[model samples]
Target: MIRKVVILSMLLLILILFMLTIEDININTSARDYLFENGFRETGSNNLVTAIYLDYRLYDSIYEAGILLVTVSGIIFMSKKDDDVL
Candidate 1:
């Protein structure tokens, strides 16, 4: 009974906290313009989005690609395993 009461109180508290939070979503036009005008000069890429991913954020892109490769290899390995254990 005490555990239930505690959980219910926590849930109520969390809900009240969530209600009190304010989120602002605004677009920055200048950032987009700057990237569009100077992306090639800064990163040597014709595409702004590609420049951001491949040049400005190469490490993150490489890590994400590695993760994808590992996930694909893991799935293949699991799927091709023999049914000896079962």
Candidate 2:
């Protein structure tokens, strides 16, 4: 009985959060406009997409790459047979 209640409560909480996020979708437009107007000047890149990705979100990209490398390494390690080890 308690487990069902907890699951229902969690579902309701998630629903509320999703509704709140949907209401604020327009807020991102201002940032998009600012980037479109000043991205080149601030980042000194001719390509807008490149400027945004390489300058504004450089740390995010680097962390994502690191995460991918670690995930791939872990998968490779886990897939290896024990007999392969010396």
lDDT of 2 at 18: 100
Across 1-55, the per-residue lDDT of candidate 1 in tens digits comes to 9999999999999987876673443556997898888899999987788999998
Which segments of candidate 2 are over 4 A away from where they belong? Answer: 1-28
Residue-level lDDT tens digits of model 2 in 1-86: 99999999999999999999999887658888998899988999989888977998999889989999999888888989997732
* Cα distance off (Å), candidate 1, residue 25: 5.5
Global lDDT of each model?
0.84, 0.89
Residue 37 lDDT (model 2):
91
**Cα error, candidate 2, residue 8 (Å):** 26
* TM-scores for every predicted model: 0.55, 0.58
The TM-score, computed over Cα atoms with residue i paired to residue i, of candidate 1 is 0.55
The Cα error of candidate 2 at residue 78, in Å, is: 1.3
